[model samples]
Target chain A: MKNAKPSSRRNFLLTAGLGTAGVAAAVATATRGEKPRAAMPGATEGSGYRLSEHVQKYYKTTKV
Target chain B: MARMKFICDAERCIECNGCVTACKSEHEVPWGVNRRRLVTVNDGVPGERSISVSCMHCSDAPCMAVCPVDCFYKTDEGIVLHDKDLCIGCGYCFYACPFGAPQFPQAGAFGLRGKMDKCTYCSGGPEENHSAEEFRKYGRNRLAEGKLPACAEMCSTKALLAGDAEVITKIYKTRVVTRGKGEEIWGWSMAYGGSDKLSDLPGGKA
Candidate 1:
């Protein structure tokens, strides 16, 4: 019936809205549980401490 | 590579507060913040000792460990620095620090505390090296300028030595050997993870 088609369309929309919300909630939860990475300059991985050439030379000068 | 470190010779320190003044001037630190200070033990006593105190840039910093936002990071030279942008001014780092290094600006109204500030070991923050933004947030980047910390450099008695850990250790050992006493280095063991007594160092007992 024509009335049944309208009800089915509403049901489809409701299902799609719920699905979208479920995905959003899932993503939010994942983001909350994730550990935030440190904002380090010139570091790609790990805790940003690196012994570059300049530091190495400075060390040589500090030697007794 | 060498890990940055500081060694304050209590025997030589005159409690002049020169290190504190130098640090404040070099950084233009605000009124309420003292990045470096002199701690005197046994005040008014026969043999009181004064030691320059600041952020030790610990091998394993407690502030970094307890930061809820994970804003603290260590540089290649082992300087512990924090990002002011990420800091919440929660005073958690203040409680976690053993040296009392974390300082919050108290100029806000309604008892509001500002972002935590502390000694950066003459090394700037995550901003560009020597940039105005970096100086505004973290003070001078003397380390990046191929120089040592101002506090140590300005010590009149050369009581405060700052540089690579291995080198300073050697320098301290020589001093202990020459003086023939005062082997204890306050906060060295706690900060650097070793025996605080310089007698433990090689040639320190001589």
Candidate 2:
């Protein structure tokens, strides 16, 4: 019983460390974003080249 | 309005000259003039790299700065195009352009330098968008048709990318990080196509 409590505390600390690392890993993945999308605002106005079909094409092609 | 820009990933480029051919076919550029080109480094070596090159449409364009006739103009979309009608064929742009984007058509036996022509970012010139006059003088205004430059679109490996500066840079950054290696200077590679790769192509330089 004398060493039992200390080992249990150590085990708790290890689990907490692993949990923190898991949370950090999840946060990092979430921030990285799921799909790579670019901001090309006002891409359809003025010129004859509207974003219509080509924008779709770009989406499929520029995959990271 | 989205500011247009071009980016090429040298690591993926195989020096196929596909971009160069696509540009010529799109613009019908004269026999002697090339709006785009490819430069390779380390031919027949281990680290050979190739890149597509053309007008970068810089934020501070040297061509626009040096032109005496003020023919050069930057579009609302940040495309730097020139008015051939106003150009004096002075060749100042050829010298001023860091990428050698300015090109002259050798139209005569006397080595005559015709009107200065360069990559318009496929946005045409000062003329009305999608106009016939615009096509004859500046080639097709694909941008007016809501498209990126043909060279970028036609790139085989998708090494060349064209679109808004923010978008392309973001995409390129994503690729550099995802691929996890090979440093990329996107615009610089296309602008200069650095000559330091170790080529491994068969039968020497292709």
Per residue, candidate 1 scores C-alpha lDDT tens digits across A1-64 of 8699999999999999999999999998776544222223443333222354544554454333
Candidate 2 structure lDDT = 0.77
Residue by residue across B1-206, what tens digits does model 1's lDDT show?
A: 66888889898899999999999998889998999999999999999999999998988999999999999998777889999999988888889999999999885767577899999988778987666677788887766655678888788787888887766776766676577655455765654455766567775551
Q: Which consecutive 10 residues in model 1 chain B have the weakest lDDT in total?
A: B183-192
Candidate 1 is graded, for docking, as incorrect
- Top TM-score hit: 2
Instruction: State the lDDT at B17 in candidate 1.
Output: 97
State how far residue B1 of model 1 sits from its true place (Å).
Answer: 0.9
- For each prediction in turn, the share of the native Cα contacts (below 8 Å between chains A and B) that it retains comes to 0.04, 0.44
- The ten-residue window of minimal lDDT in model 2 chain A covers A33-42
- TM-score between predicted and true chain B, model 1: 0.88
Candidate 2 C-alpha lDDT tens digits along B30-138: 8978999998888889998888889988989998999999998877878888888998888888898889989998666665688998898888788766555777789
lDDT of each: 0.79, 0.77
